[model samples]
Target: MILSKRSLLATATAFALVLPAGWAIAKEQLDVVATTGMIGDAAREVGGDLVKVRALMGPGVDPHAYRQTRSDIVGMAKADLVLWHGLYLEAQMEDFLNELSESGNVVAVAESLPRNLLIGHEDYEGKFDPHVWMNPNLWSRVVLNVRDALIEVQPESEATFRANADAHLEELRELARYTTEVLSSVPAESRVLISAHDAFNYFGNAYGFEVMGIQGISTESEAGLQRIAEMVDTIVRRDIRAVFVESSVSDRNIRALIEGAAAEGHEVTIGGTLFSDAMGAAGTYEGTYLGMIDHNATVISRALGGDAPERGMSELLN
Candidate 1:
């Protein structure tokens, strides 16, 4: 019981070697290390019992500024498959991820989307917005990326992968319809969504809303004095009632926007927190990709005076 560390390790190693065949058999699950929870969820949904998934960036962790921890690097090194959003979503870790491809199956799932479907980044040259998950229809395309990535790691599970992906896509189809039906109920002119950053362009395009953000696309890009001043002017001039904040981003910039609008006699209030770069708390209904979209659609519909169930598409489901 008081064995030295080295002796304990040696004893455990011997025990492992002497274990019964079934007990000694390794679990046949691909070790998947995904950078984002959205990707991680897809891996779990598609891979099912065939993959053990881990997400590097959890709820409220901004991927735009996230640098890999030593544990993340070690996990990725040991993983059978690796997935990231790409499209410059992980701006800070691009080089590191690129280098990983040389040694393993590191793939950028969203980057595989056709350029035509992507919104070009307004400020950055030759870059596209990475928040494709905002639109359930477009997100279906990314699901295929997850499917293919899983298949690549475990070719024998192709049937399972395809079946799970098809099911997920069908759910997305329902989600898209629900989003359209709910968001369309809002008065057309009252459809402007002001938020912490320019992360909702895809959501706006998919749902027909004019989106404005205090900062540019990447949260890494800071909002300057003039930018805040300009936004305050826009809010007052337009008489926008509700601005939203992002779950992964700081509310400091949004608070400034609120203060500035108040100073100008505009009563803009924080609408609701939306999931942007990250999903919601794990194990909650909002944690899943489906739940995340449903929550946003329901919240946006309610806050903007649209007709939607308060609990979402189905009161029983969420």
Candidate 2:
């Protein structure tokens, strides 16, 4: 059949218009960058298939002393939206986060929490401790902030993000209740939590445990001979049973405490490994924030004379 060039062009245009919107072109997925695994996990739950999320610090990496590499800088620069835990959690990356916020793509999730509710660092006047996520109830607020940020970045997907966030928040609440119930099995006198580092103040506050760390709040702080001596003295004097080692920091300091106690005829065993600064490997239950907390709660409860389930699952402890 013979056809004029103008008629052919018109037919092609009509066919293009009749195609599905997806066939026309798929929308570009939003690029999301989160500071840590916990934030990344929350973002993933909220974003689902609508966004690409990248966590700057992975499992077992400490954020307090984490220096951003060149790739991290580039990633932050390229990200469409960024979520970071503020309240001095990222002390080294503060400037970068503030710059990103000025550029209008960064959101500090912890900023949503009210100041009066936060625990203040003793040495740092007027600065609140940044470990708000230790409480799932407080963490829900951060998750909601992440959802709002995602909606702001891609308003069309607001409903999906909101729904996902609601579901995830419910899970967090349940986990919190579970943690409380599990911890209740421990006798009040035995509820002492000692670790190599003092990262669990918020956890202690939430769970009613007396927390003592060999090191200070920030891992960057040094553990001197006096600090070790003090902790060892406490261990011997109180006859404490178990001390924990954090995955991110070196266990040498903790081992020294144990040896010092042994010299004084006090026996202390490591309770179990705790995920303080980071999560477990991906795909493992410990990789998720809830799983990490559940593992710690179970291990701690059992080690401290509580009736928590062994192995944390159906199988025996590995």
Tens-place lDDT per residue, model 2, 1-318, is 222444433544555544433222224778888898899999998898888777888878999888766456556655788899988778888876675566458899997688777888754677887877777788888899999999988898989999999899888887888788778888998899988787888889888999988877778778999989989999999889899999888899999999999999999999999988788898898988888888888889999998887756323323
Runs in model 1 with CA error above 4 Å?
A: 1-26, 316-318
Clashing pairs in 1: none
Highest-lDDT candidate: 1
lDDT of each: 0.86, 0.81
When summed lDDT is taken over every stretch of 10 residues in candidate 2, the lowest stretch is 17-26
lDDT of 2 at 140: 87
Candidate 2's TM-score: 0.88
Q: What is the lDDT of residue 249 in candidate 2?
A: 83
True-vs-predicted CA distance for residue 124, candidate 1, Å: 1.7
